[model samples]
Structures are given as C-alpha cells and as structure tokens.
Target: MGTGNTNWKKDFDKAVALHKKAINGDKQAAQKAYETLKNIKFQVNNHSLVEAYFGSSSALIARDSTDLTDKTNYAKRGMKALDQAIKLDGNNVEIRMLRGNVAYRLPEVYFKRTKTAIEDFQYLIKAFEGNNRDISKEQYYEILLKLGASYKTVGNSQRAEETWNKLLSLNNSKYKTLVEKAKSTGGE
Candidate 1:
C-alpha cells in the first residue's frame, strides 16, 4: 500500500482520540469510532492502518455486551489486531505499548500474557536507552513506569525496583508522586 496521503495523519489522530474515549468507557462513542475507522476507504500506510485496526479492536472490546463469549471474542480480535500492528512495526513504541497494556490486563484464565508485556516493555526500554532523543520526555517516563510495572508483574521485583529508581531519577513532575508511591510500595 502506498503511503502518499497527506491527510492520513489527521485521520489517524481522530481515530486515536475516539479510541481513547472508548477506552475510558464510552460505549456508544466507541462503536461510532469503530465504524468510522472501519469505513475509511483510502489506503493508509501500514503504521496508520495498524493503528486504525487497533482502535477498532479497542472499541470492540470496550463495547457493552452481556455474553461472556462475545467479550472474549472481542478481546481476542483486539489482540490479533495488536499482533498485526506489532508485526507491521516491530519497533514502534506506541504499538508495543498498546499490546503491552492489553496483555498486562488479561486475566489468568484468559491466557494471561504478562510475559509478552514484559518483553515489549523491555524492548522499549532498550530502545530508549540506545537513543533517548528518539522519544519525548513524557514518553520516556511513561515507558519506564510501564516497564517497571511489567517487571513487577512477571515477579522480577529487583528489576522492577531498579526501573522505578531510574524513573524517580528522571524527576518527571507529573508522575513523580506516582513513581514514589510505586517505589515506596515496591511496585506492588
């Protein structure tokens, strides 16, 4: 697919905004967003298209449905979409974060993929370490927090502590308290 569209960025941003709203529990809005994303006829770059699929999948998962099977199916679809996104852009921090967050939240009964989350976070950590300037300060802090949490989830308390310590050293004003709290609690 050609990546020539100048408006793709705007469309991608709009879809992401709707996806965020859906994630925050707006079922109707999520459905609408999913529809809009799905209906986009223009060919976008793989990265943008992957994000659109991810957004659609998120909306599906966020949609209210009473059936357990339906919920599971939706989640599975989302995971598949995320997997595709990751495959499309293996080093994309945003794609990795999306999969990491989804895997981290999955229940043990539903194929808990916490290890996958840890792997993704670690990849991000390594990438950031190699080139800190590749991402913004806010993004760096967010990755550190997620990496720490993922480490803790995988029972690597020492690594988690180390990661949290690094986060504290960053002195991110917005998340300093959060990092301190997590650190104080040993990344519980």
Candidate 2:
C-alpha cells in the first residue's frame, strides 16, 4: 500500500497479488490489499472495477475480522461498493466476477447474498457466450463451477449437475483433476 508508485495498474496488480496471498491465509495481506485498492481507485479512470476490487478487498478484510460488528460492517460496506460497481457497469466481467464470488462466500442465512451471486454468475455465463475473449477460460470454469454450486444451494440439483457437466469439455489439462472432483462432489 505504498504511495511511491504512481501507476494505477501496477498498484492494482500488486494488490491483486496480495489478495491471492490473503486467500492463502496471509491475514496481513488482506489489510494491505484493501488499503492499496482503496488508494488505486482514485488513481484510475475506470472506477467500476477499481471500486469492485476495493469492495472485494473489504470482503477479504471481513474474512480476517475478529469482531462481529466489524465483520458485518466490512461485509456490508463491501457489498454496497460491489452494487455500485455493477450499477456503473453491469456487464463488466471483472466487476461481476468479484462481486459474485464474494457474495457466494458470505453466509447465506445472514446476508442472503447467494441469490445475488446466482444472478451475477448467470450474467457472467451469458456474457461468456457473447465473447470468450473477454473472459478467460479459468474465469469461465470458475463461473460455471460457482453457478452450479449456487444452483444447488438454492435446491436446484438438476441445474447443478448440468453445470458441473459442462466443465468436462473445458479441455484444460491443468484443471483436469479439480474439474473431476467438482463434478463428482457436486461442486462442494
């Protein structure tokens, strides 16, 4: 979260790397990514995605939060930023992906965000049909995976099976084992 770097993309990518680290249990990385993304949001011309990352960074912070009130507040703040990002650019691939994934991770009973995750994943799937160039194969795979899980979460096992089945044709050798596991385990 250094201010020495003037380039927004570099700062954003660094924060993204920190986010990845945070996901792998590096708790301090989450706070750094949050601050970095927040500052980079003001540095960029495209506010939607930067805002989306800012929001996702907040969710990452929420994951590491120990206090109940802080957790809820950060999660809510992140959701609001995500909603604003989507409103700014509903079809944006990155924004939808971030928001949807974050929503999916939050507790459904408390936040009731699974439905929102479903909607965003559904949008991402449809968007992929129009242009695969914008959505990487990994993203496409993740979208299908999460979409299927979201379907199952809402009690629609049939669609979940259908979605998981789609991953087999992905043809990516790197995820071969993971794909099989997702299909076999109902995306659990």
Ten residues in sequence with the least summed lDDT for candidate 1: 39-48
Query: How do the residues 1-188 of candidate 2 rate in per-residue lDDT, one tens digit apiece?
Result: 32344688887889989988987889899999999988886666447877888888899889889999999999999999999899889978888889999999998879989889999988888888888578886788878878887887777889887887786677766556775676577555
Q: Report the lDDT of model 2 for residue 145.
A: 79
Candidate 1, position 15, lDDT: 68
Worst 10 residues of 2 by lDDT: 1-10
* Candidate 1 runs further than 4 Å off: 2-13, 40-48, 51-56, 63-66, 132-134, 173-176, 183-188
The most accurate candidate by TM-score is 2
Q: Best by lDDT, which number?
A: 2
Candidate 1 lDDT tens digits, 99-184: 87677666534656778777887777787778856666677787788778767766788988888888888776777788767667
Q: Supply the TM-score for candidate 1.
A: 0.73
Measured on C-alpha atoms, candidate 1 has an lDDT of 0.68
